[model samples]
Target: MINVLKQASEGLLYMSESEYPFEVFLWDDSKQKDITPECVLQKVGLPVDTLVEVVELDSFFEVAIAEQDWHNSEEKITVKKYQHLVQVLKKYLFDLQVMRFGKINIDVYIVGKTSDEYLAGLSTKVVET
Candidate 1:
């Protein structure tokens, strides 16, 4: 499944999972909002079940940097820096995929099912946080 990132804090996803169809949330004006499943599909131009995975850059890079052999103690990755890196990486990766494949067929993983099937199993009701 391709993970689509919509929020930064991990807990926010969990808190809103009971409400929205997806496992992510967006905070606006100190209120949590459901990032509609349609939005995700629109961004990737793929169906819902395509497994759009979300990357929590700060947490991800923290573990990755620690696991890597070349660890830098002087330079550390902050949330802001991580977000910048991820933005740049996504742009380049998206461009590379389009250039090499002529389309975004595979995104980090092979999609197992269409987003329609995925959304069917989710709640469509709009919830307020």
Candidate 2:
């Protein structure tokens, strides 16, 4: 599963209004019953008191894959890359989620349950005003 994620995310950057690379991570103890904002924070070693916001997967992708200028080849490529990554994540994972921790500078986790019941996916940082 990790290998699949690596291949899907290779050379693709999450456009948080800023470009950032995605890093794959797996949490062996995360079960479907244990998926909560607090639980995720703890598993990822984030401060327990840190602010956490949850956004639906589709909502995250709506902004992430928004159309760019038609003339900018780079921007077009980026959109395509994100689209492809989204498809791969949806195809391989279940109970997908998007979590943002913090204010202007946010830690983003796009995680879901793998077939083996472990939580695995990608994490990245985004700076937003």
| lDDT at residue 62 of model 2 (Cα atoms) | 90
TM-score of candidate 1 to 2 decimals: 0.25
lDDT of each: 0.30, 0.84
What does candidate 2's lDDT look like per residue over 1-129, in tens digits?
A: 789889989987767668889999998854666567887888878899999899987788796577766538887777877788888899888988899999999999988888887888899998999
Clashes of 1: 12
Candidate 1, 6-69: lDDT as tens digits: 2322222112214222232221222112334344454446665554444333333354234333
- The lowest-lDDT stretch of 10 consecutive residues in candidate 1 is 93-102
lDDT top scorer:
2
Candidate that would win on TM-score: 2
Model 2, residue 2: displacement in angstroms? 1.0
Worst 10 residues of 2 by lDDT: 63-72
Clashes of each: 12, 0
